[model samples]
Target: MGQEREQRPVGVRRRTLLLGAAAGAGALALGTDALATRAEAAPTFIRGADVSWLPQMEAQGYYWNNSSGVRQDLFTILKGYGVTAVSLRTWVNPSSDPANGHCGIEETARLAQRARDAGMQVLIGFHFGDTWNSVGVQNPPAAWTGMTYSRMLDAMYDYVYHSCNVIKYYGVTPAWVKIGNETNSGICRPIGGVGHPDQMTGLLNAAYDMSKQVFPNTPVLVHLAQPQNLTSIQNFLNAYGGNGGKWDITGLSSYAQGGNVPGVLANMQTIQSSYGKPVMQVEYGGPVGKATQVRNSLRAFTTGLQGFGGLGTFFWEPEGYPSFNGYNSSAWDETSRRPTAALDGFLNV
Candidate 1:
């Protein structure tokens, strides 16, 4: 889930609010002033990055330095590049891969604090499984195997609630929360997979309900990869909603290298028009040299979804991690160890 790409021949990877109220007289004047101030304030456009590999990278003694030659952390470098938000993914138990086991709740919370301190909004992605959950893999956690469907649903709710509480304990609330990563086939597996639409919807609702209980104000996103597969996306959402699945936002993953930007833009428009939910390009990346093209694609996506509650875009690991598959096209620039034009796309947007 952290690595949003599919394994290929050294290539390929795909991946608000307001208030009101008032009293009388002097209180009314104060309320009016506050409202006026809020109305006058410019709206925020989210430029985000998913640094789910940061903890492990730092644990391995990797360090990111600023352009000034001063040593800095990943979050600091991201902020300097005009990234306004950071997304982190969490696993139920990453002990299966100890070296990459830094995605537990505590580690994610620590990273979330860093992003928050850097003045960037935080997004929490729950892969649900103990490891990767994508189109090719959506296995349940080792601990969740053999459980009855009912029990699995209960466990989902409990896990989400507990994980969210831990993040809140760290004094960092996520601006957005993804119930599952690249869940085109559905979350968990067998019991929660697309084959069992009812069970899938039940499991999703369980997680979504619990997430809202913990962070009522945060928007919950239902993420799916391969934005070009509009039919699959439409079917999934149809089944989800038909079976009572609910989501506050529609999340997408697209890669310019895959040549799906046009389809992705069309899908975003369809989601907004059909579902009336905000659309977010939660994950996107391509070859560093085509940064300008990627940037234009994102700009078009944002512009299309803007009026229909579009939130903006997030690049998935623009600063690629060698431990992961090490796709050359994904990272900003390997030599400089700093952001390249690929990341500048977001800044420019």
Candidate 2:
């Protein structure tokens, strides 16, 4: 799922670390120094794209071309355009509805492997739903329905831990892990809904704890959409962290269009300053066909982040063409089947 406007949207690792003793030993050995080295060597700014739809697109015979007019793999085209990372979304027991299908842990792990093979870092986004999970809806996975709150907590922990272990089995350790997608109203409704901050934070902390247990080095992020709405973000964080919630980074979904880039960036700065945590634009893009405006907006947003405590920005579904989904914020040119100049915003940032 790769849609802008709070709609459809869009890792692996060490061997011998799966078992009980070995995992503990590996965790002990993977201390602060190893993690520090990775953090230090990473690029200062992350230029990423959420190509969660790549597999389905390719399965349906979609192809892409590089700037030189030569057909190539999507990953190759993205790399050629300065995409340093890829974001893949995963669901639990998802349907098989083409555009809304797949993305189970197995599929996601395979995709993460593909990203790793392409030499790009990975960010695994857990939707915790069978379909779309966003600000408007937070339905629990089918399997988790009708369970008691205690059982739900157990289920969440097991899901996250199992998912992390599966990704590790693919030999890909993600650079970042997102607990839930667009949890502006909280995740896994009723039991863990926004109105119940205690339950909400319980679910978040469970996911965070399990994520850290598996990949202690990777930063666990808590995501909320529409950062320009400062009050909403501040309230969510206040309720979350204020109620003992845990998060390593503050992830935001900023679909800044045109002149709003500066305001969005300022809000992001305020978030970082307010919480003393690094902020990442985990999702952003412009309307289709507005390559010039999109490029300028991205340039301004990323440039501003480079000067502040910002970690990265990911354009949602740059590979999506007009005929793909109903989505229209993609940066690909339908006729040329190549990226528009809009992607140049990531260059040198």
Candidate 3:
């Protein structure tokens, strides 16, 4: 199964522009090297999207042909909607899946390049497996199936280090990297499952450390599904901390239809109050045609999150139109190729 399997029910400095001329003059007076040494500030908020299906969609000859009869790339369309960042998932060997190589490292780098070109930051989410991983399953890559716990941890480190370098080689370094995707039950089955917090924390720690080595400034995230399941999240965090796990951010996945907005809000509040780390809704979706409901739900959800150390929110596959694979819903219109009103909801958020 792919990300679609999640249907199983579990889960700016604008003022700087005006100062540009003066800054440039000052830099020239001080020294050109002085300006080059200044570091860029990170964005205050993260308004993002997960468009991991772009490569697959294009491979199938699908273009963003809007109702206006104009052709535009998906990244361009997303940028127009006020999206400042993109989340992409990477698999060890996606070719093994029927999706035909989507989310593979090479494809992920390609999409990340496009996102950078569109002036959006990248968030590389590693599934740490060959295929989909969620609350229901966390299958190890075929090569890692029989590895010992210690070996698996080392392999995870090497994979994350090399993958980050690969994306960097493509002229884009992810602002954030998710050590694992929706890993509520833990990752790399048999050994790193939730039952084995020691091993799970070891794997997470290895990935986090290696990722930091590559992108020292990037924040590593540990993602979980079912934001409403506050108990499950607390349990995982307790086990993780008890086992000495360390991560910089908390990532979540929730759907309005599956979890109520109030529960989601409460969970976000609890996560921040208990863990003291920023949270981001890494994946969220609702009915395709009920734009108003989707918009209102997100409006309330995002608003609640803002007061509780929330980083931002991302809608999963809002561009999943002309449906491919077994996933279809909460997507932009096929004929218009424009974001549905539900997606347009982000504009105000």
The CA lDDT of each predicted structure is 0.72, 0.83, 0.75
RMSD of each: 10.5, 7.3, 11.6
Q: Give lDDT tens digits, candidate 2, residues 1-349.
A: 1121112111111112234434564454355336434443456688899999899889988898888878998888888777889999999999887678789998999999999999999999999899989878999999999988887887887788788888988899999999999897888998888889999998888787678777888887889988889988888899898887877678899888787888889999999888866788999898778898998889898899878758888999888876878778888888888788889888766
lDDT, candidate 3, residue 188?
A: 93
- Per-candidate TM equals 0.82, 0.88, 0.84
TM-score of 2: 0.88
Q: After superposition, how far is residue 216 of candidate 3 from its true place, in Å?
A: 0.6
Per-residue error at 148 for model 3, in Å? 0.8
List the candidate 3 regions with Cα displacement exceeding 4 Å: 1-43, 66-69, 96-101, 257-259
Best by lDDT: 2
- Candidate 2: residue 113 lDDT (0-100): 100
- lDDT-sorted candidate list, best first: 2, 3, 1
Q: In angstroms, give how far residue 51 of model 3 lies from its true place.
A: 0.5
Q: Report the C-alpha lDDT of model 3 over 257-345, residue by residue, as the tens digit.
A: 52478877887778866875677889887777776788777777777776665788888877776366556565577766656677656
